[model samples]
Every structure is written in C-alpha cells, then in structure tokens.
Target: MTSPSDPIVLVGLPGAGKTTFLAALWYALNHSTDGGISLNALPEDQAYLNEISRTWRQGEPQPHTATAVFQEIRLCVRYDGADVPGELVLPDLSGECFQQDQWADRHWNQKYDSIARAASGVVLLVHPDAWKGSPRIADVARAEQLIEGSVAESQGEHVASGGAGRAGADESDQVEANVVDFDPLRVPAQVILVDLLQFLIGDPCFHTALRVSVVISAWDLLESRGRTPSVCLEKEMPLLHQFLTSNADRISCQVFGVSAQGGPYEDPRVRQNLLQMDNPIERIQVRDADGNTSDITAPILWQVRDRVVEERECRGIS
Candidate 1:
C-alpha cells in the first residue's frame, strides 16, 4: 500500500468535510511527531497543506475544491518501528464533480479511472449537516403501503384466476413482494455513491482492495446537538453506511469523529483553545468545546495499522 502507485485517497462529496479532514490530518501529522506516525513532504509540497492548516486554525472554513480539477497531495509517512515507509496520494475533487460523474450521461474520465484503480485505500469523509436523506425513503414506504393495500383487495380475484401467488410455493410459504419502482425526486446522493462504489470496486465478484475511513466532520456540532456520530450516520447517510458495510468482504470500514478547528472562530473561546492545543509536541491535542485539548491522532494510527495488516494478509505473509 505504500508504493508510489498505491496512494491512499480521501474522497467525499462537497460539504462532506473532505477539506477539513485533509487539513486536520496534515496538521496532526506535522504537529504530533510522537504518535509513531510522521509525515515528511518537501518544502514545496508543504506550502499547500501548510496554508490549509493555517486557514483552518484561524477559524475560517477552507474553500471547497473546484470541480473537474484534479490535484494530487502526496506525503511520505513513517511509523516509528516499521520496516518500510509509505507515500499517500490524496485525491482532489469537488462534490459536484463527483455527483456529475455519477449521473452525467455515463461520461468517463480517464484520470479518475486510473487513480481509483491504483489507489491503496480511501478515506471517505462524511458531514452529517451536509447530507439530509432523500424524500424517497418516505415515498418508498408509502408506495409499499399502497401496494399492500392493492394486493389485499385483489386477493380474491387472484384466487379466482388461479394466480393466488407465485407458482410452486406453499400457500404458507409466502415470499415478500418488493416494489420495482422507487420514485426518487432527483438523482439521490446514495445513487451517486452506489455508482461511485461500483466504479471503484471494479469487479463485481471480488474487491481487490478498498479501505475506507469514515470521518464524521464537525463532530462537535453533533455532540452539541446531543447526537453520537453513529446515530448521525445511521439517520442521515444510512444508505452509504449500508452499502459500505454490506461489502465487508472487500471494504475494510471504520468510523471516527474529529473536530479539526474544534469550533468556528465566531465562538469567543476558539482562539484560546487553539492556543493550548497548538502544543508542538502534542499534535493530536484537540481542544474541547469548553476548550481543553484531547487526542485526534488515534484514528490515523488505526488506518496505518489496518493497512499494514491487510497488505501483509493480501501477500500471504505471516
């Protein structure tokens, strides 16, 4: 997974907090040198991520990435006691562009295909605030209800026509009927996501590799509203969660909560919290909402260790 051809890509829709995660990950890697994980990028490579970290620390939202523009952010990484070093390439894409690629007349991009195929793994950032489930869930439920009602009304007619049920099954062994048409108002976010997963998964029978870290952005906001990240994901992006989880054979998935800037700058205490969390040695330090630092590097380490283990397993090495 550390090969130049195997970059760990960070992917998400616009407003899904991809920028925030990238900035936060970069900052943690650079600032927290003691976490058994380290990042060394050239000075020229440092400028972009550096500025992003700075902007985020200043309490302003980083700009969303522009559509159709592909930039590769690569970093050399080392764990304190690892035999080999690794390089990760983060993807540059806007949510709109991702959406467009999924639904735009099946248009193909050579660059996207190559990058995805070559990816070592992926970090899929998700923002609860940005994803509100489609109206289709309710629509589907209503349709199901209508279908059941109509089916009940036609039961006698079906029996008279000798079509009481599906052929060759016991009367008591009824199979559930499913609606063929799930009338969605617009191309749903999940639909796009499903298509993207299909593209990335590449093979229908097997997944060569797909490591996904689900970072729930603005975690503090969810906590403030008395919600857990898991609950938020279940409520808001259940389809994505279900889709990813269903493919456990190929997709190694994990969920984490991180508040990069802690809170927005508008909050009077944000600046002070940054002051404390800005400790040079403790890059994982994240300020509390009330403003005290806590560790933010554990999730990254989890990814690293998981990647190492999986890569070794794939190679059939003990």
Candidate 2:
C-alpha cells in the first residue's frame, strides 16, 4: 500500500488551512511522536517541510500557496506496533485546481487525473467561514421582481417612442446582464464537495470504498461555541453531511476539528501566548469525533496506517 503512485490525497479550497495542517503535523511527528504514529524516515526533500514547520513553530502565518504550485510530499511513517512503515504520499496541490479549474470550469488536468486515480484515501479540508450558502428564497424573489419591473418599463418606453430600436437594444442588454451569470467560484461549498466526491466514486479508474477524513480547520473559533466536529458538520453543512451519511457504503468518513495554530496568529496576544510556550507542539489541537487530542497526526495516521492495516487483514495478508 506504500508506493509512489498510490498515496493519500489532501483536497480543499484556498485558505482552507491544508498547508497549516501539514506544517503542524510535521512538527508534532518530531516531538513526543511515539506511542501513536511516528515518522520512520524523512523524505529526501526536506526544504519545503523545514520552511513550513519553521513558520508554524514561530507562530508566523504560513504563506498561502500560489495557485500554480503543486508539491508532492512523501513521508515514510509507521504506527506503534506495526511491522513495517508505510509511505504516506501527499500532493499539496493548490486548492484552485480542485474547485475552480477542475470542478467549476471543467478544465481537467491530466496530472490531477493521475493523482485522483491513484489516491488511497482523502483528507478533505474546509474552513467554516468560507462557506457560501445558497441564495435565500426571499432574495431570489426580490431579484425576479426587479427584473420584471425593468422589462415592464422598457415595454412602456417602446410604445411611447413607437420605434425605440437603440433603446430596446440597451434594455435587452440590461436584462441580460441582470440575469445572473453562474460564477463557479460562488458555488456553495457543499455543492462542490459533493460533486467532487461523486466524481471520485463514479470514475472507473478511482478506487472504491475509500476512507475520507473531513477536517474542519480553525476549529478554535467554533470550539469556543461548544461545537464538536460531527455536530458542526451536520449543522453547518447539512448537504455534505447528508451525502456522506447516505453513501456510507461507498465511503467511510471521520470528521476532525483541527486547530493547527490554536488560534488566529493575526492576533498579537495569541501570537505572544504561543511564542511563550516552551513546546510549540502544545499550540496544536486536534478534536476527533469523540474528544480532543494533541496528536496532529491522528487524521493521517488513520488514513495511512489504521485503514491500511484493516485492508490488509481483510485480504488475509500476514
């Protein structure tokens, strides 16, 4: 199960905290990394890992990934009491590739196709504040009324002028402009995610019975309001929650609330408090469906180790 071609994939929108989570996971793995999951060997390429982890430990903000950047990370990792380590390959792709380029515009890249075909598991990240909900019924009704009034006024002008050719053309253009052009970026978060998952399941080359880790980043904001990861999913994004629940046979999922930076680093007080901590690992918090944990590797470990073992056992592999 550990190979270059078959890897666990990370998917999310820009600013969804995928990069931050990776940095925290790298830091957590190196400190008190035993008793759960630990890195067996670092990848030959440590430049990217070093840079991001440095910012994470220093309480500095991680730079947003440029849309054109696509980094593949390979970590040789092992779970406690496992016979051998597994190579966890992660493609740290730009979120735009998923939402804007692929799903929205249908500008599918062959590279993404290869990655999707070979992915063994998926970590889907979502920022709570980034959700773009569907337009309200009242708002839609109001827009329709405005368009109708404009058309009626245009018709009255046409009769008064008896041959308002240019005026009629301008009114037609206005009406056409008023007709909302679908912007792929504005598609509801849940809608895109659902469509993404459906693509995975429907595609013939992709693996079936996939395990997914739904991570809600910046969990500190929502945790303060006494919301668990599972509850947050159900309430905040019912469409995604229902889709996952309904398709339980095709995909098994676990929701995690990850506060990779503990709190927003933009806050001076928060940054100061984090800097004061002797161990920056303490600044990381991971909430499972059940409870909280300090291990930032929980989600990846579940995907690369736990599920891999389960799959092997079911096949009677000794």
Candidate number with greatest TM-score: 2
* Candidate 2 Cα misplacement greater than 4 A, ranges: 1-5, 132-177, 305-308, 311-318
Candidate 2: C-alpha lDDT? 0.81
Candidate 1 stretches greater than 4 Å from native: 1-5, 41-43, 136-186, 203-207, 224-228, 266-300, 307-318
lDDT of 1 by residue, 137-236 (tens): 7779998999778667667667787977743243334443432454332556666666766667764433455766677766766656765555666677
- Model 2 alpha-carbon miss at residue 63, Å: 1.2
Query: Pairing residues by index, what is the TM-score of model 1?
Result: 0.71
CA lDDT of 63 in candidate 2? Answer: 89
lDDT of predicted model 1: 0.64
Model 1 clash pairs?
14-95, 288-292
